[model samples]
Target chain A: MIDYQLLDALAAIVSEKGFEKAAKKLFITQSAVSRRIHQLESMIGEPVLIRKQPPKPTAIGKRLLNHLQQVRQLEVALSIRSLADENLQDSPLTVKLAANADSLATWLPEALMLPKAEKVCDFRFEIIAEDQSIALKRMKAGEVMVCICSNEEPINGGLVSALGAFRYKVIASPNFVKRHNITSVEQLTELPCLVYDEHDKLQHQLLNELNKSVPKYTHICPSSEGFKQAMIAGLGYGLLPTLQLGDAIEQGELIDLVPGYFIDVPLYWHYWQTESPQLKSLRNFAIKVASNKLETLA
Target chain B: MIDYQLLDALAAIVSEKGFEKAAKKLFITQSAVSRRIHQLESMIGEPVLIRKQPPKPTAIGKRLLNHLQQVRQLEVALSIRSLADENLQDSPLTVKLAANADSLATWLPEALMLPKAEKVCDFRFEIIAEDQSIALKRMKAGEVMVCICSNEEPINGGLVSALGAFRYKVIASPNFVKRHNITSVEQLTELPCLVYDEHDKLQHQLLNELNKSVPKYTHICPSSEGFKQAMIAGLGYGLLPTLQLGDAIEQGELIDLVPGYFIDVPLYWHYWQTESPQLKSLRNFAIKVASNKLETLA
Candidate 1:
């Protein structure tokens, strides 16, 4: 097994470009840094450094540096969560999560509510527009702990857990629908439509389902919050996450245009396939929250 | 103009969960942090924080936090590069580049070398899978300064510079080709093929071009290094970049089959649309290197 502490020392040394400076920056002795590097190289049976004027990293060293950088970020986040947990005496792990704008504006908030709340882990959410592959990359990079990904294929070296299917319905604010007298999605192309930027295929997918062309005149609102606000303010019609419509539906602010049709998006939870206690706790909490929210809404 | 520093402070405070603690972590005074937060809230014209118990970020603050995180990373990278340049006294603006595996194994190294040393900056490369959309996202997220993207459509917030085109030819080690007695591509359908993981479209694109069915016995090589090694080791014959094969062909390591027919991929340079002097220097270096390489090779 790889000693993570050695990897961390190596990454710091490589980033600083010398053991002396890395030691000074890390508040450690230069010999300690040197020893750590030596031990790591001996363990790996490969020379990781080219001890030139500035001590360049060998190819293997660079690869290890990249991996170490990712690991270091994860460590930092874990440390912060630990600190937070100690301070609060309840919150333990911080699960940094990223999802699409519509999903964040829709069902994600409700999914943050933990049922058991055993270890007192706090959940942090971020809305990003990356595709599934990119989402997996972020997860691996340790920028985010959990990713709500569209990919059915499991990311290499990551745990795969199903989050059930999320369906999207073509929706419009009641005022906008009433003012435009909109009924079916066939007239979608003619009406001004709000979209989640260029990469968002929700509108295109809906148009394709209706066997109609994608509208040429469309306004780009990249955030789900902004998209929902725009639609409510009568900017345009859009396909919204069914969960996003719940409060609006109850308040009589928004309504589905085409009742029978919806796009079902299967979601999965992908995390780094590690045996850390905090990661497992986060995974369980997310699964529980996802199940409860999905069962209640779907 | 948005003050990036304010956003970073806000994100740190939100992540830290309290004013005093966030200040201590950032090595700043609590009053300073409080003032910054007030300024941010005033500028955004929204209450960004909930002051009850451990502070929580408002929904808009959370959105800002995500954007600020990306911006903070870019700012950190830029600062690190700037500091490295100041200390190293030479090659301060080393460009961190990202590309697909095939390009890295093939034309990218050639393009990295400028005819004149003065025309080049220090270079660092991160090779990834051929999914250019992911590369673009990485570039946008500040993981890389430059990227080779396939999509002609401009990355929403980045500038695009054309780098001519790279053509991929179906090739194999001469020994393997001779051993298999392969001539026509139709025969290739019967032979084993190599692919770059499931997401790779190279072999599929070749088959589509030939109007032939995909070979069932496909060897998967996930990395560019692995793919090249597999071809050299005679694991299977597959498409190789024309640039990558040049030295191999001359050295009698590889042979092109039906050389006239090849896939032409128009490559483009995508970078952040910033006017920073460091970015400008790196951009100019890339353009010079790319143009010189293309002129010499094409």
Candidate 2:
């Protein structure tokens, strides 16, 4: 059996980036931390960390850290169960989740504001906003407890739920529409297009459906908020999430380029197959709220 | 001497997260990719990757990848210098940078729009929006070529420049201010505060300056845009960046709480000491633009 304390020390070293900082966090001496790491390495019969300026974990160390995190989650669940009647007021839970940038900027806040999600207040959330592909990869790597992603297929031993579709409409500032006189699909190639990034194919996907290729000039704004702001400021035209554009569109700040043409990206929720009440509560709340917010395809 | 081809294959595998996908990216067979990785491990006399579902690089692998990226950058610089008269239109340079979210949302855009920065159109930019601490860490790790951060100290073998300061003021929606009747610092604890995240100390920093503790109720909106929107929607008060708040305040959407109390966070630019013309151009352009945009300290 592996000693969890030694594993914890190894994880701390990687996360805190040094033995001294890890020792400070763990409230132990640096020598104690080093000894624990050494013992763990001896037990595994291999060095688990590179003692560089900022120490990094080896592949075996990463596996050990991953195992430690899983064990920690189980322990937290056990503690919560044991103290069921204590209301969990004193001990606040921390939930680490991976999500796409668009979701975080749009309906996610409202979803978290749902009455059932008030429990979210009792928890600290570490949200890692990333592209859908990267988010899914992080989820599969056990880096996050849950993920809101575009991947429909669930990972092995994980629960997956359909959270409806996020519809994106090709939109631009009202001024940009008037200046460019963009009415037909062919004119789109003449005007500059705004893309989220190189890997972002939303603009291309829409253009491909309309049998149009990407324009020569394109502005890439990586942040979802920056992308919207750039569009609002008449930087270029691109697909904006319907949920995020409702207010802007209503205020006439943004105008849909081609009416009745939109791309609906199906989103899914994936969580670990665990008996943790907090995870179950969050997953159910998210699905319920996302279902209400996102467009449902019949 | 390390084989850059094998190193590239290893980096691709770690980044793409799968052997098949890495193979596809390199335009090589999956078996060939595996053989290169095997050869690299044999050459290094140690395994360089963990064969997990989503493969991860070992410490040695990570160092090798970092070295490979640095070498690639130098090679690109050499090629650019040799083809100086070719106008660099055919070959687009890529500059990876790290910056705070607030900078990305506000002044950074205008800085990128500067006349000198028009040449930036020739380069592809990968701007990673992260906190100052994390940004500094990534710079130190050599993951990013340059970073806009709060750290004034230059990293070893790097250059640092002061980019003036970003001023933040306590701001609330007009309705929220009227509803709460917040006139004194003592009443601040009664109202709910909006924070970007737990790491965000702007609110706390302001409160600390005024000798006040944090409120009992606080709302965490991690995104810079979301934080501003939440304030505009009367969710809670927050320390809004002066650059972002100008339009909102002028439009009467948000009101400043204290007339004089504002915090100015000094920002610095850190980049590698390199003879690369692209790096020099970017550094000079960024410094010139940021100096003009940010508030200079007397």
Candidate 3:
């Protein structure tokens, strides 16, 4: 039988990023923390951790962490169900989710509010903002319990459901289009543009649909709020959600470089097929609320 | 003498994240990319990359990356000066900066505007949000060219200057304080609180000043915008910047739990002591803008 103490030590190390800090959190000595990991490695007959300055988990270690997370989530739900009545738990349930920043800035906030209003679960969120194109990695890497992302393909143990879409437009200031004289779609490749980060593919995907090569010059801004701010400041033309850009588009403060063209990037919720009671409620409310708030995919 | 080709290959590998992608970017075969890395490793007599899935830089690799980045920055500045008469460059300069999310949401945006207003240099930013408590690691690891952080200490080759402070207060919904009957600071340790992440130290610092133990329950939210939304939604009490919470506090939508008590987290601009012409201008303007906008320390 695998000892949870050994698993807990691994989880703490990953969380704290060092044996000393992990020891403090676990209320054990640093050597004790090392011994637990050694014991775990002996039982598994494989190295779970790569010993370095601030150790990192191996592929097997990530799987073990995933297992521990799922088990702990189940334990929390079971305790809430059996020991306490209603949505009361000994502590607030932390639902770690990976999501695209655009969704977080717009529809997801409203979706977050729904669970609280409907009394689905008394939980707190730990949101990790990843570019939509690569958010699936967070779930597959065992970093998060669920993911609200652009990718529809679910991981092996997870289920996927449609969660509507964010309607995005390639936007620029009037000065930008005027300065570059970008009247035609084919001319876009020569001008500068904005990308959320290296992983952001919205600009490329939209460009491909328009039959243009990627813009040679790009500004990479990782913050969603800052991304829009940079676009408005005429840093470069790039795709942003119309939900947040409504007034700017309507008032001509920000012009849609592509007049009528917009990308309906569909969002999907990827979560464990087998879920705890609290998590099941979160999944239900997130989908229900997102469907009501976001642009529906045809 | 180190070959620029080998350094460029190493930089591309780090930027593109893998040999295959780096090969595509550099217009070279995968074997060529491997050969360059092998040559770089041989010259250094130490491994540059960890050779894992998505190869991470070794300690020496990071220092080499930092050197390459600084050299590239100088090259861009020289070209901008000689080849281009104006702020015009072959490509816009990209300044990768590490900053806290709260700063990004607050005064940093205003500071960002000043450079563009003055035409310091035609540059774009790549921002990485690391919590204020641990942001120095970004500079030490060569992940960012510059950093706006709370840490005042200068690194080996970098300098730090005061950028004023973000005044923070312990806050909650009026209903929350009443519901918990939390009139005294001692009772706060028992109630649930909100934290940005494990790396965030503001709450603990405030708690220490208040002579209280760490809160028994906590909610971790990483996004600065969403963090406030959660706090306002009565998810949990947390320390937030008064700049964003001024109207909320005055209107009683959010209450300052510890009346007349605030923490001024001093901000600093950390950058290389020797800077390129474009970067020197940026340093001048960022400090100028931030000093005017943020809370002045007594």
Candidate 4:
């Protein structure tokens, strides 16, 4: 039982970063913003903001902000549904989501292009490209309304839907294979390999399957595009997503190190289990698109 | 006083995520990897890694990994210096660094291009497009050896160098400006604005300076390139870095709302305080290049 007005004030203060600015954003007086925050703190029985130069929300405050944002989103969705004008020009629905870089560069745009999503909603998409673990954390923290992550488990009462497998192949530029005379896993050990990040386990998984050791030297490129560019530049060989590799493979810019050996990373769509029509539409669209775009494990 | 061998085994385990895989990576038996970890733990009197599926490092373990990585970089740098063949085909020094997205999209490439860096080091860059706060946290956690961040303060004995100011101008597409009939800061509130993330303060700061309130709605695109693309697509107005906006502005894609009202975010380069030659070269190059590229306040 929270006051939407007070919550609005809180969100504005956090986003605008101070009482003075928050007051202006809400079109209220500075004193009003202060009083509202004081009321919130009194109700919560704890300080919400650190009250620094650029004010930062405390852990509890951050959680409340997340809560407020979620509530606001639900309200927006409800309003969208209640509107009689089906042809309303501006849908007023903003969806904040997080996804991995590979998805952002590939199937995500297609998934978002579902007719229902495009026609009904004036979709304002705020997409954050992050690692699966970080994306999951953001979703749990309520920083994002939805997250495309590898984790199958749902948290904070979120709904989880399978998005099929993202298959990866150990790939290198044609020049690298010929220059290193790499025909086997043992040869790969002597050459530098490219990794997405320290948290990336795909290369190790491939080597494990091959019964080969990790190379002493490795190149790390945290961005999906950078990883691909590095491989194309002959910096190192790496496990690249099939979605991203198709163009390069067709162009003959890259060659599969071992054609038959591949790893399939299963992806899941996680979203808050809400009755909002917008969320339902998004969920259905995502599932349908992912199934079509992602590789099937048959 | 720490055994590099045990640390290497520990790093391998954390990166590879299993004792068996770590053993294979280290070219040792699984029993030996286990024995080394056990010996290291007994010496330290604490567990270093969480023995879970896809293992994670403990707080102390993460710090040790950072330390080991730093030590390895120094060893490589020293070896490069000692090599008799100055024209050695490939220098083995790999530098792992973190930088903000704006920097990565702008002046960082030129900084990395200094002749000494290219010739003497085989750069393995992990470009993390993170905010200054997160970038600072990662640097403090020893996740990166050097970071180009906005934080002026030094942490964990890291050296800090001023890398001039990154000037930002509030801009919008010509079409957006004409559609909204935006002529002043007061008009901005009626339209949607673009934000880098929830933590983005530049828009608020601009509004505060103009004595205006923040808009009720904003479009958040966390990636630098995406932010620019959104603006180009006439999504919203935003405070874009001058470096990123140069070509767009020249091509008549964007127009500055207020000619003189700009925010100059002072950039800083922070790195571990080490006498490593590789770090020295990188720091020097960054300072020189940043001074030439970034704007300076008189």
TM-scores for the candidates? 0.40, 0.70, 0.89, 0.63
Candidate whose DockQ is highest: 3
Off by over 4 Å in 3: A28-32, A84-89, A113-121, A174-188, A246-253, A256-259, B84-90, B113-121, B174-187, B246-253, B256-259
The Cα RMSD of model 1 versus the native structure comes to 30.1
TM-score winner among the candidates? 3
**What's the true lDDT of residue B267 in model 4?**
85
Q: Fnat of the models, one by one?
A: 0.00, 0.10, 0.31, 0.26
Q: For candidate 3, lDDT tens digit of each residue in B1-298?
A: 6798998888788878899999999999999999999999999999999887778888899888877777777786677668655636445678888988877766665466443456645676778878887888888877788888888899878888888899998988876777778778888776777787778878887777787567677777666766666666666788988877847876778888888999998888898755777777777787887777789865
How do these models rank on TM-score, best leading?
Answer: 3, 2, 4, 1
Write one digit per residue (lDDT tens) for candidate 3, span A1-298.
6799999999889878999999999999999999999999999999999887678788899888877877777787677668656547545677888888787666675466443355644666778878787888888867888898888888878889998988988888876777778878887776667787778888888777886577677777676766676666666788888877858877777898777888898999988766787777777888887877788877
Looking at model 1, residue A189 earns an lDDT score of: 78
Q: What are the chain A TM-scores for all the models, listed individually?
A: 0.67, 0.89, 0.94, 0.88
- Worst ten-residue run, lDDT, model 2 chain A? A112-121
Which pairs clash in the backbone of model 2?
none
Per lDDT, what order, best first?
A: 3, 4, 2, 1
Candidate 1: segments with Cα more than 4 A from true spot: A1-94, A109-117, A120-133, A178-184, A295-298, B1-298
* Clashing pairs for predicted structure model 4, backbone only: none
Error of 4 at B186 (Å): 2.2
Cα lDDT tens digits, model 2, B1-298, are 8788899889889768899999999999999999999999999999999787578777777677656656776787788767774867544566677888888777665454324334633555567777865678666655677789887898766789888898888898888787778778777775677777656877777776775676555776677776776677676787888887757888999998887888888888887666366676766777887888788954
DockQ comparisons of all candidates to the true complex: 0.01, 0.18, 0.42, 0.19
